[model samples]
Target chain A: MKFFRNLTIGQYVHKDSPIHKLDPRIKILTSLLMMILIFLTESWWSFLIIGFFFTVNIWLSKVQIKYVLRGLKPILVLIILTLFIHLFTTPGEVIFQIGVIRMTWEGLSRGMFIAVRLFLLILTTSWLTLTTSPIALTDGIERLLSFFKIIGFPAHEIAMMMTIALRFIPTLMEETEKIIKAQMSRGADFESGNILKRMKNMIPIIIPLFINAFHRADELAIAMEARCYRGGEGRTHYRALSFKYLDKVFFMIISFTIALIIIINVV
Target chain B: MFIYLENASYTYNLNMPFETKALDSINLSIDRGEFIGIIGHTGCGKTTLLQLLNGLLEPTIGHVFIDGVDIHQNKKGLKEIRKKIGLTFQYPENQLFEESIYKEIAFGPRNLGITDDLLDERVKKAMKMVELDYNQYKDRSPFELSGGEMRRVAIASVLAIDPEIIILDEPTASLDPQSHASFLTLIKNLYQKYHKTMILVSHNMDVIAELAQRVLVMEKGKIIMDSTPRNIFQESVEQLEKIGLELPQVTYVMHRLKQMGKEVNSGVLTIEEAKEEIFSILKVKKSNNEIF
Candidate 1:
């Protein structure tokens, strides 16, 4: 019955903790580094190291473990697909065979490795988003992308769009909840339908939602123009992003973790 | 049917960091054919209370009984309970999505399995109730209508279901004065002619005074006052002002006159009642002056 309740993308849970207090740039860079290193991980011991660090970071973040796990539910299908693809196709010593399908130790191990890697990758990225507000994340992204502006990248514009879209997620979610309740009151059965039937039922919801979204977009454009929102050539942020000593310390800790992970993979 | 909420409470985003208690220890009952008005400031759980009456939400702490039977005891018949108590939400026009007005109004009864001849009859009957011509407008798209007309169509959609009790959440919101008066009259007819147990949640004290026999004033979460409109308006001007609500225009005038040394009853809810009260008080004052 809850349509957008499980959606966690662009959701920021406010908590006053070290991870939440970390510089958004440092948190973004650390997440990117972890994503790359997780793919480079080839052994179960490496996953154990990554998983341990992840669990500790999550604990330090002060967000509920159950809430973080709920964000993982949407990607379960992808994880299962990756696991099965690795499990059945990889060439290895056969442990069991039925006709052309073979179960192998290598396949099982590779499947587990890929599953853990994907899980950790998703977990770290979501953790980055969970700890940082959308405005701060966009600021971090814009700052990082400014280096590429010499190559004619529209970094500020992109960052602004991203921030605006992220800001609308909760608003749109509330609107969708309203529309769903409206339809439900009219005896529109969103649940208890087959796949096709359910999609048909969703038509009642999706059309009105699109109309409202377009209307909102028009109103927002007018409001922005009224405020004289020109492109961000010389626009300065009200709350400027500055790197404090704590940001430097956070960067050092992440660099040390990355170095340890690389050494584990190489050795 | 009797509707009772016993010590009911609700918390949004329960068990999450953003959890909020919207309703708190609300205990109220409505007998059949009673016109009840619920008034409160924004976010004071007036909408939440309306949703609870028809089972749109379940209380986190207490039970909601419809005809002395707990509707949530068996989830199997919950839909049946919903159909029996029609709920037209605020800005109901947003619910219109069918291709034609005919199909739009028929959506509810069709879901209830009324098909063939009875469906047409119900759709036409509902449309006529809202003053829309079935022959001319049935094939027209609901989106093509004016805002006020579309609002009526959305309401007609709910009426097609023909429930025993109808709950409207601010039905006249955002309408012009002319349309607002007509809409209230339409609701009045529905209440008087059909004897349906109507529960209206409105911010307009005048509308509540004009229609509701019983008024339930909500503050924060609980019902602070539940009594006749006369009793509620006559005495609670100061308390209502403290809660960010104002008395009806007529009542406010009478209240001001009473403060200015006139022996006027401050519970007048309409312009006509205020005029009669003023005239009676003026006549009595003249006779006393002549005797002196």
Candidate 2:
């Protein structure tokens, strides 16, 4: 129960490091490019190169390596499960056999590639999220999507939704823990019950949490309307995103590295 | 001692970078049928102490005993202890999920294996204790009630279990003045008529002065002062003020009289006591005037 308070996922870490100071639009764009490069990566050389890039980016962001790795914990089981499945199922040169469970050479290589790819994908996105605040992220996303407005994209509404969701994650978690404790005080056994019983016990907690969430949503809407919040039409931002000299330098560096990686892959 | 904590301490997120010591070696003994008030600032471990008492959280260091038995020693025993100690959280109405108030208040007792006619009786008794008419409000959805009625229903849910001890955390925090006064009266009646050991946690000094037999003052995760309400208000006014705790309003009035060169006792707690002290001084002045 105490762990609920510590259930912090990869949220923004406020710091004045170089990465945090860069334009969030550039960060989002580079992160997108990095995802592409990660998918195209099939060799250890490319992975090694990209891994080095992530190390440098994380260092520049002033975030500890351990904190970034902690985000990988929830997915570690999935990664390992995939690796084991690949080890047993992929048909190739047999490394060994344990009662018809054929361990293949290609399977080993493929599993390693997939594992490293997923790991780097998580690392890159977490890097972007950790360095940029939600407000900045929402602003950057809206600006980027505003380019697609000719396709009838509701850029403002989508950005507002993302911002609200990100804002309430922590608040919701606190409320959840409080509801659980309140129920527990009334002798509701959340711990020792079987699956069905445990789930049934959760009704006491979930119902109240939902009621409170809906109440909060209603109040927030009223509050926003009271403040005369119209749609994103003709609305300006408090933080007007600007591309600066430093942004140009980082942009060029990232573009050059990604270009070099693409050329190597093609050749 | 019916309920006792022996050097209980709680540290959240142990071995993590953001670990916090919420309670620091609290040793306290509370007898049965005792009405105790715990006062502290918002993050001063009062709620944590309440949770520890009812076995919602296990103490990281010490032990909590209910009737000479360690509640945490066995799962079966802990549930029984929970039956003996009912806890109502602040805005407890949020936990109400049943379609009707009857099912809502019956939730606790039903969980304890009371059912059929026994369950019906318990629900009716609990509703009556909160001053809600059983037949009128039992079938209504808890969500449809006003804020104060919903709270009374919430408190009734705890009372359904018939726990000898009831722990409330800021039970009257956001109530209207009328509801607040009535709520206090209800609590006083619950304690006096039913002999329930009431452990109330509130920052409202006047409420504590009126209701609590003893006061426990907390600061920085420690129990710094434990005394009768009048003694705590009279003797520790300066110390409490230094720690940013507000004493009862009437204590200040009495203290003001003492500071104005009047021979006034400076430790009155409630409005009634303050009025009596003032009238005594005025009556003596009139008698002296008649003699002259």
Candidate 3:
């Protein structure tokens, strides 16, 4: 029934904070660097460092811990699967045996380590999206991708598509809820069905949603045309992005964190 | 006592940072076979109230009792309650999906586990109810029909359920004049023929004036006024105007004449009544001039 409420992923939480004020390009770059750091780090101490960095970023972003945690709800199964896979399968010194299944210390540590890494990786990207508005995020992506324009890359087009997609997420979700409610009013029980039955039930919701989306797209294309919206060529922005001192400071802090993680890995 | 909202309140995204109280604690009731129209400004919680009425949304506080029992108390009976009150969303055309009109209209009865001949009967009945010829439009793609036809098909899909109370949210919105009039007529026929408890939500004062026996005016998540449509459109002209709701054309004309110091009844509900009121005054003037 509630689709938009728990939708924290790629949703910008408007809050008065330094992270909110930082340039989107800097935030995007730093998020990317932290993701690489999360992948590279091996030692448990490195995880603690990355975890601390994420906790601080979440705090600075001014989004609630609970809101950020909700973003992981969809992937909770995958995280648990990774942890269990390592625990049951990784060969190591057996701490105990349950009918040919060994509970090894190495397996447990490895599982915990991998789980933490995956969690931190998700936290990094979500933090960027949470703090930065979708428009700014697209602008950042466009600016970063503009470098490839030398090879005739469609950076602006790509960014525009991403911007539209992100902007429509909540709208589409709300429409989806309406369709479900409308169907439910017709005695359509979406819940309490076998998986295949539930999936088949989705046909009623999906076709409407897809058709509505196409209708909206067609209308939007005409609207843009009526407004004389050409491609991104020679287009200027309404909100000109400027990398201020705050963004520079934030950039340096993240760079320093990344260097520290890299040095820790080398050691 | 048929359907009641006792101190019901609904808050969207409850406890979240973006939480909003869409409905304040309010008490209301609807009798059987009553045609009630709910009108309000945008974001005034009209849709939210409709959702609460049909149990699509559970009130954050208080209860929605249907037939003297709280509907939310038994989760299993929600579908039954839904079957009792059909809610047709605004732009119901967006909910139509089946490849053929037959399957689309049959969706509701089919969901209730009705099958084969029984389902076909319901679909045919619904199609006929909407004035869409069953034999002509049954096998045709709902998507291929015109906007108004698609709208009717969508509504037929809901009517196929044969709910005791049918709730329409902005039924006449975004329709051409012909379709709007025809749609209103269709609703009127349903009320007269079936005696279903008809609940319609529309911002159009004319629609409310024409149909609703009782009108509920909502503001800021609370039902501010519950009165007959005539009383609401006439007695509360200034207040309704202040709230940015336009009175019906006839009501507005009558009110305007009254404001101009004319001897006319400002409480007229229809154009015919307004015309008679104005003619009465003209007759008085003509007789006065003759005496002079």
Candidate 4:
């Protein structure tokens, strides 16, 4: 079995849609604003509006709907359990009683609302990752954090670390698979047994994984040094960020939608 | 028989968006005391096939029988099958983790429940087989060793299990010529001395020609040819070329010489064999010209 879950984190689905082509910085800022609005507003009707906005964004991103749904698979059980607990345990105007359990209409509504909020949050974030490439995301973060350079925040260093970490995710995953196979061949059984036995079995696999990661880190540092990489100083990018008219238009539409959601909630 | 794959087919990320059929309907039986070589281009399912032999991966479609028992059927005792078959991965030295070289080699035997005297003996024997001195390297950290030494320690770790079948995937990859030759010699000696069944996966024609009696050629996810190395290199050269596998340098030279009307044998694989054949041919020609 593969160690790394196929969760599709930081994965970009290459597409030539308008949403995909918009500057990543614009998309990043807009999504952040939308997420904050989602958490700020408490009204249910406003959430429906937010949900509609996300659905449109998902459509514009042109990523496969099936893939986006697959990314939501892991949270399904958690959401269901959460809803069940909230519905049965909350003591309000008890509409039904079943052997020391009380159920209320208010609890049911609140549980449904919480579940919807979670679903919308996950879907929107997944849409962001699907449309934006990792490199572009790092670039956006670095540019936005450049404002903190005045306060000695080491923004460039942080961005470089993030980019490298993202880059090595796949490599380390492949290495982990290899090490697991190696240990397995040596009679290291990781799947069977109780929790303690299984955890004890992971010792061999984890030790080797850590060792290989350190080895790779050392080699990567040497290679980077040999190539004269010095903390992103005096560096020029191959692809420069240029804001297009569409980026401005997309930003305006997102801001307007957030404003409308807020106004609707307040009224 | 040591290991067998019966109509085994494996697909990566099965039933997912990224699903890929890595192996397709592969049926092969590896007998004890036999050396088999597997050669293929990149992404030709060579590594996937190797993982199947050791039960690191279960076949999606069929059974993997190690010593005539289906391994997947008994999930709890599958560890025993793993102990019986040792698989050394490509660039396996990267997985070195033990603080000392001795402990690293002892890892496998210890996993098999060998204790004290037998454990020490197994470790020493494995180190000796890989030509690493016990006293000189037993306590040293594996990370501090040279690249070639680290590779040997990795192989020794597998050897400590004393498996009936040893599968090495590209054991000599990324080594200097001298180290490569020495590694090949060590593998050859292991085969001769222990008579353990070996499944060697490599793209190096010279190593395969010297070690394997039988060779399986893979292209994509299918086994294209399975025959003796001599027959494969002699008869299937064109097909192998089409699949992007180059012949050994000596074999290429031998083929060129035959094409140029020289009476050199096409099956000459090693440089020494080619040298002897060319010298004998020249000697015979010189005597005939002197008679004329």
lDDT of 3 by residue, B127-224 (tens): 98999998899999999998899999999998999998999999999999999989988999989987888999998888888899999999899988
DockQ of each: 0.55, 0.68, 0.76, 0.58
- Candidate lDDT values, in order: 0.87, 0.89, 0.88, 0.87
lDDT tens digits, residue span B95-164, model 4? 7788999999998888778999999999999998999999999999998888999999999999999988
Model 4: how far residue A205 lies from native, Å: 2.4
Error of 3 at A71 (Å): 4.9
Query: Model 2: DockQ against the native?
Result: 0.68
Q: Over the stretch A1-267, how does candidate 1's per-residue lDDT look in tens digits?
A: 356665666667889998888878888888888888888778777778778888898899999987788778889999999888888898999888899998888889889888888899889888988889988999999989988999999999999899889889889888888888877777777778689988888888998888888889999999999999987789998878888888888778777878888888888
Of the two candidates 1 and 4, the one with more favorable lDDT, higher being better, is 1
Model 4: which docking level applies? medium
Better of 1 and 2 by DockQ: 2
Measured against the true structure, the TM-scores of the candidates, in listed sequence, are 0.88, 0.93, 0.90, 0.90
The lowest-lDDT stretch of 10 consecutive residues in candidate 3 chain A is: A1-10
TM-score, candidate 1, is: 0.88
CAPRI tier for the interface of model 3: medium
Model 4's TM-score against the true structure: 0.90
Off by over 4 Å in 3: A1-4, A15-18, A41-94, A97-99, A105-116, A241-267, B282-292
Task: Give the i-RMS of model 3 in Å.
Answer: 1.0
Who wins the DockQ comparison? Answer: 3
